[model samples]
Structure formats: C-alpha cells, structure tokens
Target: MGLALFELPAVSYEGNLKEITDQLVILVLDDGRTFNFKRSTNTKFFKNSKALKAAELKPGDRVALVAKLDDRAFLVASTVTFVEMTAERSAEIAAGVRRAQETADAASPVRGWDGPQLKRRALDEPGPIPDPRAGQSPSDDPLIAKAQDAALSFSEALPNFLCEERMQRFSRDSRMIGWKPLDTISAEVIYEDGRESYRNLKINDRPTNKKMEELSGSWSTGEFNTTLRNLFHPASAAVFQSAEYSRLLDLPARVYDFEVRQENSHWNIQVDFQKITPGYKGSVWIEPASGRVLRMEMQAVDLPPEFPMDQVETAVDYAFLPIGAAAVLLPVHAENLGCQRGTDYCNRNVIDFRNYRKYVSDSTVKFDP
Candidate 1:
C-alpha cells in the first residue's frame, strides 16, 4: 500500500497562526518531507494553547515539528513544542536587540558630523585639518562606508518596499496615446514676463521640477537637505510601522516592523500602518533585492460620520529603475474615492514621469549682474 499524504511532513512552514489563514496548516519536517493536514484533525490532537504566538517569533527562531497532510495543505501535528521561547524570554531577546541598535547608532560618525557646525577657515589657517576618514584609505570616509553599508542593507531590505503607483491620465483610455517621453523632453521654467527664469534642466537629470518651477517664479534655491526632508516626510508618516513591507524596505526608516516570507525564490512582505482618530489601515508589497515597490492597499476603519470616505486603495509598479535613487523613472497608477450624496465618487488618475529626478541646483550670485 502506498503511504498516505498525511504520512509525509509539510514542505515548508513559517509564521504564526494569524499569519496563516487557510483551513489547512503547512509544516515542514526535519527529514525534508512535505505534507498537509486539516486544521480540524490537528485541533483535536494538539492543544489549542500549543499553537505558536506571533509575538514569540523573533528574527531568528527555528522550529521543527511533525505535520499531517490535508487536501492540498499541511497542518501542524503533535509531538513538538509550539514556541521555542516564552513571552518573558522573548522580551529579554528584544532588549538585546534594542541594545545592539543603540550601540550601532552611537558608533555612526554622522552622529557628531554636523555640517552646519563646521567652521570655515582661511586658506593659510592650519596644518592638516582632520580628514574625517583620517585613519583609513579613500574607502574609509564614514559617509562612503555608510553608503556602502546602506546599499548592502537596502539590497536585503528592498523586497519589502511597497510602492503605490497609478497610471498617467490621458484623454483616451482604450486606444493608445503617446506624450513626450520623459527622457526626450526638456523643460524650461518661464516667468510671467516671458523671460526664462530657469532653463538649465536636462531631461536625463533627476531634479525637483516642482521646486524648480517655484524658484523660477521667485529666484530662490532653498537648502538641499530641507527639500529632501520635505519630499520624504509625508510618505514616511503615512505608512504603517508594523506592516511587513515596512520592515523589509528599510528606507525612509520609519516603517521597519515588517516580516519577510520567501516563495520559490520570490519574496513577499506584508507592511501595514495605522492612522488613528479617523482610523485607517495601509499595506504594501516590495521586491526585496531590487527595492521596487510593487503594490499598496489601504482602507479606512471606524470612520466618523463627518468623513466623506470609508475606504481607499492604491497600487504602483515602478519601471526601468531597478533601485530607488535619482535618475530613475517612476510611472504612478492610482485610484481614489470620495463619498458624496450617500454614494462613492470614484476617480482614477494615472501619471507617468520619467527622467523625473531630484538634485541640488544652486547658483552663486555674484551681484555683478
């Protein structure tokens, strides 16, 4: 007689009960066997309390358990401890994690390297001023080191970044229409007086066009750092922290409590963030290695009567740019809805931008002009 499916172990298993939604639970055994079992069968065999708690699973927790096979899924079987550690033990583990993070933050050279604090000296002032990378080679500057480290870390975290993209809005939908591609188009900001205020933007470069337009109207180039700060802040604050994508995509750093899952070499991350008062839930998907955000979904919960909308959803697919940085192209696909007259006013908007880049554009005013 052939061995029944339940006789085998699950192919692979990770995540807590809440994370797994199907009726059948899957578990991978130590012997490299795969099986699926019905949740009903396992419910009687295993104590309800024996199930692993999501909070108990840390970054590096491994467990081996027997599994029974159901129709097309594997469920956890008996004879194994559900959690490797208790809540108290997990808390201690978390404390260690916190300390490590703190130590790392303290050691970062940028902590004390305030650009505004650096004093400008005369040409003949001193012997050799301290090179930030003094003890090290050209590769030793902390900034370079940090960038390298960030790149590596970002490579690992890229899979979880979720980007909400919307298509560009055009008059025609069924038929195709072509506008000036971002790369081929050059833009010059012209003032009301018909004089060119700013005319130096190359289509290939990544610079803030909105800011450029504003400055063109009133010849002022603001601080570079401040512009980056403003552009990134809204997205950082909107997304959920505990969402899986947040943890996987480490950029914008605010959303970092994500969990990663790999399937057939393709990784999936679930990132969620909440907005209180008028409750809202947001989630997204990220391509780990490439840091390409694939999709974003959101919903409003327990909305107040005064609120016009009850739910929202968005998804974005980034093209061409394999990594998140300047000079990369981003075409956005978005959908939105607002409540009006006891009905939802749904609108779809698509924006395509390429060679849409951001950079520091500054000019020294000699006052001779």
Candidate 2:
C-alpha cells in the first residue's frame, strides 16, 4: 500500500527546542507550529550520543523528524537524521574546479588577431563539397559557405554581448507572506576560477508595490544556485541581441564582422562590439561537430558606474559522446569564479527564498546541438 503523506517522515524541519522537562522535548517550528517529543533511545542513527542529549539541540540546525499528531499538538517519536545544506556541496565543487581552471589559464598563452584580413581570407576560401541535381549555389545552401559566414559572424560578436541581471533579497520570515515566490525570479550568473558573479535577470509579469520595501544587495555563497540558473538559461542569447540594453555593455547593434579559431574540438569565435563604448572582448566555444555553445567568456570595461566593475572569469565543462547521428553535450561539471569580497557581510544577508518555479522554453535547444 502507498504511504500517506502524514505517515511518511518529514526530512527536515528548521526549529528550536522550546521546553525540555523530564524525558520530553518541545520544538517550535518556524511557522509557529509546535510539537512535543522524546528522542528514541533505541535508535543508532545519530553518530554522536550528545546529539540526543536534551541540552544539545539548537534552534537553527535542520532535523529530520518523525512524529504522530495528537489532539491539539504533535508527539515526536524519532529523530531520523540531520539535513545538509545545499551550500556545502556547492562550495566543495566550486573549490575543485577553480583550481583546475587556474592551472589551465596560466599554461595557455594569449594570442592576437587581425580581424579584417582574416575575414577576407575566409570569404575567398572554397565552399563545401557539392551535391548533384540540387542546382543550389554554394552560397544559397543553408549549410554552405554563406552559412559558415553567418555562423562566424555570430561567434565573433559573442564577446561584446552584455547581459543585465537583477537579484531580490528577502528575510527568513518573508516566507510566511507567500507573496513573492522564489521560483519566479530568473537570474543569469557565472562562476569560474573561484569567483561568482551575476550576468542578467528576467523579472516581469509579477506585481510590485511602491509601499513594499525592496531588498537589494549582493548574495551569499549559500545562494549560489540562484546565480547558476541564470547563466545556463538559453534566453540569454536573445538578451545579448537586444538593441537597447546591448549598448549598455558596449556591443554593436548589429554584427558585420567575425573570425573563428580552433581550440581542441571547439571553435572559438572572436566578435567585435565596436559601436558599444569600451567594446566587449569575449569568445564563444562551440562544438564543431554539433554547433552547440559549450561555453562562453566575455570581458568589458566602461560599465555604468552603479554596476559592479570587477573582473569576471567563468567556464562550463561539457562531455561529448556520439549518440546516433549527433554528439551530445553532457554537463559533466561546472566551476564558478571565486569571490573578491569576503563572505562575512554575505552571511548576515542570507535570505530564505521559497516557492521556486522554473521557466523553460517550449522549443528548448539541446546542449549538444
């Protein structure tokens, strides 16, 4: 038989031990719910014996609990386990990846380019092998020489693309209001070489009040997931193409010139956002066989004064394996850039965001293609 919701043990509850008298301990839930229970003396799950001691239970530590509802309250029967915060895993992975990227950057040598001359040479190159009876010109074919030119142009302009992101902060108690759900907020973030940064944000279709005080500030390490989702969102491409905001980061309204270079199995395209002031310098790493953006990196100066101007470096590592006619881009791992500012202030600003909803496109592009 399927278990009922109440019968199943709740994994974690953030609460405090309210009253401890005799063998019973009372806990006050964050939502103002209350429960009375006693630690199971027969269980061997808690690693330390002190974990069961009445005085050792703290207010903030998440506890996995099992309880039975009584007439007016709950009776806790057992303490199954303790909950591990997501930040613990995020920090561990972020640390390992940053070290590997540092070694790669140091060993790789920087190269310069002559844009116009390179473009001319590519234009004069031979077209793809022909097909009989099609009668299509080399330039007319969708996968022909001209298509290569268009792709190259798209790649070159990538460095100059700028994304604008926004973040909303909420207090721990704010979850009770159920007004602004955490899942609705969309953000683009980049983390690489032990650094974390925001790229852009898409927040609309929701109501905001002038009377509601805005919680605006930086984020904490525990909140890294918010930024991670933003960077991986596919709509970021469209945002870079926007005429109004694109100029803010110094990228051209249109891409007329582009150049391509090869790095391993990936093609790196250098783009010029010349019309945008201070210009953008960046490259898009595409899988040559599948034409998917494996990763992208861009740097720009002359940002608006209010925007943070710190240097940013990030990378997303992908694993490619043939799956029938096309290669698939599998997310083997990702690394974030380290923070320049300390985490002291961020800890104080930690906000509990709840009710998250993810927005995915109807025509989603596979990471492989």
Candidate 3:
C-alpha cells in the first residue's frame, strides 16, 4: 500500500482575548478553557470588515478565529475577526437604559448613594475627626495594625458556610430622583474552602437556571470577605492616610481612607464583554474595641473615558450573626451603584445577607423568594 497523507480541517473558535503577542494569541473561551492560536504572516485580521494591525489588538476583545493545523501539528490562525455587539446583547443594554428611565417615573424609596444629600454628607461631614494619631502616618497607627490583624484573621478563620442573599435592584435617571423598585433576586451563596459561589437563583420570586453573575442588569458578589481581604492584605500595598476616630452603627470605629493603585488593584469591572481594572479609593470603618471591620466603601477612580461606566461605587456593612452554633461576622447589607457614561441611566442594587448555616456536602438548597 502506498503511504497516504491526511490533513485536518479548519476549526472555528470564539472567545475573549486574554493576551496578544507578536506570534500568538491567547483566548479564554466562555466555558473557561484557554486556547493558544499561532499567528502567521498569511493570517488576516479584521473588525467590522476593516483590516486591523496586530498591534491594534487588545486584551478583553471578543474575537472569532479560524485555525488549521500546520505541518508541525500546531493550530495556526488563518483569519481573526473582532466581534461587535450581537442583537441580543444590544437589546439587553437597551432594556437596561429603558429601565433607568422607567425608574424615574415610578415611586419608591429615595435611598441612593448618589443623592445630593448623601453626597454632601460623604464629602463634608466625614472630615478628619480629632484623634490621637492625627499627626502620625496611618501605617504607624496601632488601630490600623489591629484592624489589619483582624481582617487577616477573618480571612483565615472563616468556616465554609452557606447563606441566603436577597438583592433588590433599582434604577433611576440623572435627575437624582427617587429610586424605583425593579426586581428582587434571591440566591444561595456558598463559601467553601475560601472561595465563594452562587446558585439556586430566583429573580422576582421566579426560579432561573442562570448564574447570579450571568444575570442581566446589575448584580455583585464577594461581599462576604473578598473586599476585606483585598483591602487589608499586606501584599496589596495599599496607601493609607488620615486615620480618624468615628462611630459606625453606634460602635466606636477607627476610620481610615485608603487607595489601591491600578498595578496592585484586584477590582475588576466588566461591562458587556469588556473588562477593565481601575484603581479605587475607599474608606474602612473598623471597630476600635475588637478591630473588626464594621463597614467598607469604595469608589472607582481614574476610569478610562471610553469606558461605558461613568461612576462605580459600593458600600458594605458587616455584622455578627449566629450561623449554626457560632457567632460569625459577615456582610449584612451592601449597596452597589453604577452610572452610564454621558447619560442619565444608572443602576443601584441593595443586597442583604441572611439565613446563614454551616455548609455540608450533601446540603440541598431550595429557592426562597
């Protein structure tokens, strides 16, 4: 029999670009698999039918590529195309904008982080409180050291637990009017082996198969301890300033304002399919007596003008609640707010955590509206 040659057919792949190099591109698929596709001189690149230079490629861009096996059995890209928003994605964005308008016309609670009154209070009243550490650097303050220790302990000592999370999503126009009730979302949050995940989701009292992070409109996770860990983690190299004595929820607190540089920031913002990391500044309220973090707030800083979001901020309040047979400190409430760039559209979410219990391997979860 004569020797025969076989050639594999070209395959198509679609994913978000994670890295782009001169010779190859790394893409992370929606299913979390990472693939590397070699680029050759014969490969063509395009966006909206327009030719693009290799240098123009950026990470986080959605791309579709066709690749064929080379003589060496390596997958080599023959054509790369940048994907624009699909009809479904465009419709979702439009619905979010429409909801922002509808919220302006509806009646609901006036509570929002962006309200003028709250803005003024945030900017003015929180002024430096007279304290013994007024003249010292925040790093030298004993209170900060104690708070950092407490945060580290919380991260390490927390046991695996499950909790019910209730989130009320709202939207409002730029007029700073009252917020309107949009929908209520309920999910089972699992903290296992120092990781957090969500399941058993219910939107507006209706069950859904979608993950909490995959939901349309605004949603957030990691309120349990992620932010606290990031803020107080020694490796984050956050800059702190202006330690002040204050009260949070009637408990004596040591307040410190801190900023995390973009190089060291773990805060990731995702809009549609694009992702960006922006530096953030925030305030942490720590109970002086126990060094526990009572509350924490953050606001994104120096966001790219081209980014879709104009402003992003969050505040979380922590409290000690009985979980199983022990009293555990966990997030009791959280507020997340974001506004569209150059538009009146904004989304706000108020989240509450309750019904905490120790997580077991065989525990079954039922959705509770």
Best by TM-score: 3
- lDDT per residue, candidate 1, 1-369, as tens digits? 997653565443332332222344344322112234344434432234565443443333444434444554324444323545578966775666566546644553321222111111121122223333233432332333333243334323322122211122222111133322222212332222212244444333444455333321111121111111221232323322332222222232111121111111111111111111222344433344444333333343333222333333333333434433532323333332222213323323333223322222442211110
Across residues 213-241, which tens digit of lDDT does each residue of candidate 3 receive? 67888888778877888888887788877
Candidate 2 residue lDDT tens string, 99-139: 64465445432212111010111221232223342443322
Better of 1 and 2 by TM-score: 1
Predicted model with the maximum lDDT: 3
Superposed by TM-score, candidate 2 places the C-alpha of residue 71 at a distance from the truth, in angstroms, of 40
Q: Which portions of model 2 show Cα errors greater than 4 Å?
A: 1-280, 321-327, 338-369
Ordered list by TM-score, greatest first: 3, 1, 2
Off by over 4 Å in 1: 1-277, 290-292, 320-332, 357-369
